[model samples]
Target: MYSTQGIEAIATVTELRSKTSALIDQAKTIKTGIMIQKNNEPEAVLLSYDLYLKLYKQLEKSSK
Candidate 1:
């Protein structure tokens, strides 16, 4: 599933590249959340399914 306001927090292109391994490592530690950006525009989200499904259910209800 795709998200519009996907991943509130973000990591820049450089941060993502230089810290790719670190990012994944962090992901394993905590429920990681990220919005990959290029030139300050949202490109995509990187988040765990646990958090995703939780928020997805919330959005689904709010739309009603």
Candidate 2:
């Protein structure tokens, strides 16, 4: 099952623009992902490199 607990933070586009570096560092440290919002809607996701690769591998395996 997918869990929402992985989302450690949420940021608006403007906020993310200004704190991009810090937020990315925070995500890495926390080992969690960030949800990016635009116009109060979830438009994107920023995931840690390890988590992203893990998910990618899982998808690839499932597709095979």
Candidate 3:
């Protein structure tokens, strides 16, 4: 997720299945990625599309 520290929020795989909309909103509102856990271990990150695009642009520039 942006290669940054600090998680705006966290949710388990089950929670993600049930509260996907809410979790997505939280990510958007906080403008930071949400750490998703599976088996109590961090497995993925959820980020708002805008934030993803911004980070992607930064990565592209740095790679040039």
Candidate 4:
């Protein structure tokens, strides 16, 4: 399971639809991820591509 320790914001599915751009900007500005929720449950994370690549690289390094 992913940790929620430092998550700075959250968006519901409906809000995601209406505020996609703002949410994405928030994620980028934070240099972290924004949790996406559905039915009051966490369902996904919105993170910048740069951050995604960074995490992917870390995963590759740790798996080796």
- lDDT per residue as tens, model 1, 1-64: 4454534467779899899887665554555477778787777666766777887999999999
Winner by lDDT? 4
TM-score of 3: 0.88
For candidate 1, the per-residue lDDT at 2 reads 42
lDDT of each: 0.71, 0.81, 0.87, 0.88
The TM-score of candidate 2 is 0.82
Candidate 4 lDDT, 34-60, residue by residue in tens: 989899888998999899999999999
* TM-score preference between candidates 2 and 4, better one: 4
C-alpha RMSD by candidate, in order: 6.0, 3.6, 3.7, 2.5
Q: State residue 9's C-alpha deviation in candidate 1, in Å.
A: 2.5
Query: For model 2, how does the per-residue alpha-carbon lDDT over 15-63 read when each residue is reduced to its tens digit?
Result: 8999999888877866668888888877788887988898899999999
Better of 1 and 3 by TM-score: 3
Error of 4 at 60 (Å): 0.4
Model 1, 34: alpha-carbon shift in Å? 0.8
Candidate 1: deviation at residue 30, Å? 4.5
| Global CA lDDT computed for model 1 | 0.71
Residue range 10-55, candidate 3, lDDT tens digits = 8899999999999988888877799998887888999999999999
Instruction: After the best TM-score superposition of candidate 1, give how far the Cα of residue 59 lies from its true spot, in angstroms.
Output: 13
Cα displacement (angstroms), candidate 2, residue 19, comes to 0.3
